[model samples]
Target: MGALDGKIAIVTGTSRGVGVGVSRQLLLAGATVVGCSRRPLPGLPAAEGLGGVEGRAEQWVCDQGDHRAIDAFVQRVVDTYGRVDILVNNAGGTVPTPHAEDVPELVQQIQSSPASDDDFERTVAFHAYAVQMNLISPLWFAIRVYRQMRTQDGTGSIVNISSGAGHPAGSPSLVSYGAAKSGLNHLTRSLAEEWGPKARVNCLALGPTMTENFRAFVLGEQDPEGRAYFANVPLGRAGDPDEVGRTCVFLCSGEADYINGTTIEIDGGMLPGVLYDAGLKTITDLL
Candidate 1:
């Protein structure tokens, strides 16, 4: 049997990207997956290697930022599945902008060149608000599920999606996004403490992964920047969506019952650098 057989899971922001990947993983593990995104997924993809157990995947269209919609969506899942065993809060993104240094150069670039109010607002809304959807909305769903789990004498898991960007000092251009993810890490810890032995809560801190969105929107047609970015990576490439999905599945499985209130970094060793690389400073200097 699959690790998550008979479990019921809710995965948010699952129309595409890592969210979709995580949903696919949970389903493949024999969980009944309720996948939510701003738009509905056309259909669940077939699991290639998993001999016979073709898992079930259901799609829901809801704005995670909308608490009411999220509440209704969670209720629908619980009503249909009878219990909620796992939650993966995975919807979030950075504000679109020109290359990190495409804008006009000016004196006092460090202090004066920070993102604008609009950028901050948008980033907070996307990153911070999305996290809130994962944290607060799931709390509402978890309360219902927890009550049921208590009745059945059962336990559940929660995994929040974070980023390596949240680890370092913070990025000026993506300050709000980084801060929001950092806050998510703390939120995971706080919730784990609150829920305790009854329910497990953890954060999956991811590194750069190659998503279709990243390729089309951020990387652009030529993808020079994207190529350079991945070239610098120690792994020599961006992570696959399935790698992240597998990690999520493992974290939610019974094997991870003892693991709680932690952040798992999945960045392929991008943070620890043996060399004194001043790429950012060098780029700024050149500009």
Candidate 2:
């Protein structure tokens, strides 16, 4: 039997990119996966072959930034699935392309206009208002899912998708973005401590990786930042979306039951000062 052969998982932001990857991994592990996003998936029906997962899959549209929408989404999931065992809080992406930012460019924006009031406000809202979607939405989902899990069996997993930018010593260019993620890290640790023996919480601090969004925006033909970005990564490359997905699986798995209140960096061993001091050219030459 699969690790989650009979479980029901709620994966947010699964319309594309890393969310899609996480959903595929969960399904492969044998969970009926329900995907959520603000808009309909452009090609979810055709993208099911990932990891060869046979688990049931479905989707819905919900704005995670909205409190009412989050509650309604949870209710809908419970009504449809009868049980919610896992919640992948992956509903973040760059917003106001008319989207909720998962990560990336917000850092650049913060750096470019560090002192700009408009930039700071826009980054939080993504378009308008002051929702602070990145920091607030995960907690909303976590609380709701925690309730559902408690009612059923007093157990559940909440994986808050974070980033390397969250590190205190992480990228300076991403001040606001990093602040949000750092807060998320704090949230993950706090909740893990508070909801123990019944619920598990953790953070995944991702480094450079190639998601659909990453490819299109960061590494793809339209805008090639090139290999220089990987200069600091000891492994000297970007991580795959599936790599992040597998980590999520393991973090939520029975094996990692004791691994709570921790943040795992899926960053290809990209440590600060380590790679640069070691010399990228020498390492690449040896490889």
Candidate 3:
């Protein structure tokens, strides 16, 4: 039997990227997965050797930035699945592009641009206010699910997808995005403490992975810079989405029951200042 046989899960922002990868992994592990994104996803074919279990997946359109939308989305999942055994909060990102170091001049331009009061509000809304959508919306869903899990005397798991950028100081261009993820990391710890033994809450702190959107954004259509970017990674390559999905599966499984109230870095040994020192030869070559 699969590890998550008989389990039910909700994966946010699951139409693509890490979210999509996580949804697929959970389904392969025998969980009924409800995937939510701003729109319907292009359907994926059944995995080889996994035909019978393929159709157990469903998708819902949701505006993660809207609290009511998220609440309704969760309700619909409960209505369909009967219960939520796992919740993966993976729906957040910034509106801007590239790292600050990659585009400091653009960052300065956006910062210095004159704006109407409304434009200023809209800017903050997209950056800072949007974070509440990512952090608080998940918290609300967790509360509602916790109540149900407690009533059933069942255990549940919550995993928030954070970022390595949440540390390493603020990337001026991604200031709000990093701040939001940092808030999520703290929220993960706090919720785990609050939920205690009934439900486990954890954060997955991720590093640069070559998702489809990321490839398009960073390397443009030609992908000329892809190899150069990968060279900077200590692993000498970017992570595959499945690597993250596998980690999520483990964290949500009974195998990780003893683990809680922590942030697990899935960055392929890219964090900690040591990785840079360990890659001294590569760094010098690049320089």
Candidate 4:
């Protein structure tokens, strides 16, 4: 039997990217997955090969940023399934694009005009949205699910999907996204401690993973610097979503029963002070 046979799981943001991988892995492990996204979940590409997967999945719509939507989503799951065995707070990707009209002004402000009130307000607005989606939404989902999970017969697992940007060194380009994820990492630990043996909470801080979004925006065929981004990684390549999915599986399975309140880095051993090429050059120059 699969490790998660007879379990019920809730996975958010399954319309694309890491959520797809997480859902695939859970279904393969024999858990009934109820997933959500702004759009319907798409068919896993032919290569994903669902031939042997024991469990099944259903798609639902949810806007994680809204507390009412989260409440309705959780209620629907519980009302239909009678219990929730796992929750994957996997919805996020809130990098705000500066308005076209303000781009030049923002650039000018960065170099010369320090008091750009409009620019500052724009950034704060984006940051607030990012925090709402990445941090507050996950918190709400965890709170709602934990209430149901604790009442169940055995332990329940909550895995918060974070990003490597959340690391202490922080994400310069993705400031707000990184800050929100950092909050999520801390939330994982705090919730795990607060909701003890009855429920376990963990965080997965991901590095560069090859997902649909990655293919479209970050590492597309036309991007020359894309592959260069992985040069410092010991593994010398971005991780695949399936790899992340497997890790999520392990974290949720009984095999990981003892692992709680931990933030596991899914990046291929890329640490702080060593990720950037300049950082590598500084160390090599010393040698």
Candidate that would win on TM-score: 4
The TM-score that candidate 4 achieves is: 0.84
Tens digits of per-residue lDDT for model 3 on 43-151?
Answer: 5322334566665777778776576787787778777778788988887654343332232233323333223345444454445444665566666666766776665
Q: How much is 278 displaced in model 1, in angstroms?
A: 9.6
lDDT of 2 by residue, 40-59 (tens): 76445424656554437888
Clashes of 2: 8
How many pairs of residues collide in each model? 0, 8, 0, 0
| Off by more than 4 A, model 1 | 45-55, 96-152, 222-225, 272-287
- Which ten residues in a row are the worst by lDDT in model 1? 274-283
C-alpha TM-scores of all predictions: 0.77, 0.80, 0.81, 0.84
Top-lDDT structure, candidate number: 4
lDDT of 4: 0.76
TM-score order, best first, reads: 4, 3, 2, 1
- Per-model C-alpha lDDT, please? 0.66, 0.70, 0.69, 0.76
Is 1 or 3 the stronger prediction by lDDT?
Answer: 3
Weakest ten-residue segment in model 2 by summed lDDT: 278-287
**Model 1 residue 93 lDDT score:** 63
Q: What CA RMSD would candidate 3 show?
A: 5.7
